[model samples]
Target: MTAMPTRGAGERLWIGTFLVLGSLTAFGPLAIDLYLPAMPDLARVLGTSDSLAQLTISTCLVGLAVGQLVAGPLSDRVGRRWPLLIGVILFTITSVLCALSTSIWVLLVLRLLQGLCGAAGVVIARAIVRDMFEGHRTAKAFSHLMLITGVAPIVAPLLGGQILRFTDWRGLFVGLGAISVLILLGCVLVLRETHPPHLRQRGGAAGTFLSLRGLLADPVFRGYLIIGGLQSASLFTYISMSSFVLRQEYGVSPQGFSLVFAVNAVGLVLGSQVNGALVSRFGPERLLTVQLVMMCVAAAGVVGAALADAGLVVLLVPLWIVMVGMGGMGANTTALALIPYGHAAGSASALIGTSQFLVGAAVAPLASLVGTDSRVMGATIALATVLSLVALWRVHHARRTTPAHSEPLTTTT
Candidate 1:
């Protein structure tokens, strides 16, 4: 129960710690994006309907949503390292199972398990950052992590497309399993326990529920969670529809679609890098306000281009701008939400992550429901952006009326 000494900045350990945490954080995106290019091929090979193949993605997201809910509080009780390690190990095992599945049903089950285990990394990494730093330092750390983790989405689809060129869709899962093993090694060697035994939550399920309820009762946390979830939906909506719209609608090849996806991901990376620089100077709340407005404008542009039936160049420009806005919004909202809950960072992070993936899971399937075209994609992005703007406005209003000393520190900004 003794306090662990904080590691000083500028040490080799700091760099290694961030890299390992970043790698862990990247696993969810890698799992989702890497297999996207293979969706059609997967359907064809597994003898399932396209809807069912798409369920593979949806089910995995469901698992991720549920897993974070479970893992977050559990990590708060048990500390970070063991739960994370177990999660990675389970993820690796389930990924291998996904590769070996002979039926789409079997693959669906394994994908769910894979996502559940993978949630440990995604949720715990955020908690670890909160454990390590506070205030603007937390925002800076998150932005840096986004910069490191953003590379996964950029590379994953391209790698998946290349893997498809030689092998089948099943090979994609095998590759994910392999990459997870490397992450497992890094977790064991580089990740230290950030949540100490003394700080760990007790009273079991009652305590966990109380922790979650307390977070939910906080208007500031709720606002940030809504904004983050809705903003994230814009990205997920694009992810769910992109392969279909680019390949089926526009006749872009799989390789070409991967390149397109990577270009947008680069926009995300750039935004995260910019946010890292600006967060300390501008503050997360101000940065979030600016980015949400830009996102609204960019999303409106997307709607216009879609309605006009504009070409790829026209469509991608607005979408890239939206991605940049998302990158900025994500770090700030997360940092703001967790600022008050250092004691239960895992549980708070879990709530934020669960909200995001749940929104994403809901939106992903709706792409098909609404019909897959640029217009549908644009409309979905616009809707999510509008919701985000509403949440941001609520936060602004709440901050204005609430007295300075009564509110959480970050909300005042």
Candidate 2:
């Protein structure tokens, strides 16, 4: 068998490559989660309504979705390193601009720009992984990436809340700016061009569109994309509603709320680590099937607890289960989706990332519409999980009926 390409010469270089790529992947999560504790303060300080403050988040999501669509094909046409570096530079500049904004409108605009720039890292990081590894190794690399990326949510809110104790909302953006600068330095020092000129897509716009259409037409890609998007919506539903539910309704303090968020994040981290160990044995498809079933059961438990007006423990336990299931399923589905499209990994990664964020953006606002009680949040999650189950079943059925020679390429072996 042919060997997978290595990013550097030794184990140390491999570890460094993973850390840099993982940090790049963490950019979006850090951007979203780090200032969540300050959302109320931001609304008050900027003289904006709660919905408008929340719009900042939704707008950022929109930018993230759109930015990936642009950057993905650009990376395919050009190369990964330049797109990544330029994105990091833009992210740093916009973070500083976001810190300096005097009006909510200004902040919203800057947040959109920040998200746009931040997306280059998120999409390109996945493509870089694809360039360097294939098959089961790709799945394994993603699990490690998840471990690194998962730390953002686990620590960001906690750190942000503590920062709020010493400073205001503006300081949060300043910190984000500083983090971006550090990431930029790391990228400059360590990141190499993974996508080569010989392999790059030619003919620019026409070629890009053709590649995108082909990916969309693939049944396997469609199945994984739908599954990923729906699963992500479940998490975003909780994210959009959790602060209000825990802090406003349940009377938890911001610090306490951060701790609650961290607990669930720990479940995600554990799940990713477990999946990493088990994926080589069971294969990503089998693992994803089991995780989806668990997700449905967990969603049901959440709905039942919410309907009963149960205590926080009942709500949190099921929510943690849902998080764990999502954490395990996300990397597997993404790896499966991109494995067959190695030549267009950037575009494939972009589509997956964009769908996940767009679904998240749409689902997040529904929490407020349905009323931000536990039941509404739980029901939103249940709905997403139900959709995910249907998608999973369709993929399973399609695989069963397809001829062995016609099966999509997977890195299971």
Whole-model lDDT per candidate: 0.85, 0.84
lDDT of 1 by residue, 1-413 (tens): 33334423321227778888898888777888898889998999899999999988878888888999999999999998889999999999999899899999999998898899999999999998888877777788898998778788777877898888888888898999999999999888777778888889998999999999988877777889998888777778898799888898789997798788888888898898899888877788888889988988998998898888888789889899999988878888999898778899999999999998888777767766969888899888898888888887787777777664154344222
Cα deviation in Å at residue 289, candidate 2?
0.2
lDDT of 1 at 383: 88
Q: After aligning candidate 2 to the native by TM-score, how far in Å is the CA of 227 from where it should be?
A: 0.5
lDDT of 2 by residue, 209-274 (tens): 999998887766798899889878888888879989898878999779878888888888888889
Backbone clashes per model, in order? 0, 1
Task: Report the poorest 10 consecutive residues by lDDT, candidate 1.
Answer: 4-13
Tell me, by lDDT, which candidate is best: 1
lDDT of 2: 0.84
**Candidate 2: stretches off by over 4 Å:** 1-13, 40-47, 165-167, 247-256, 400-405, 408-413
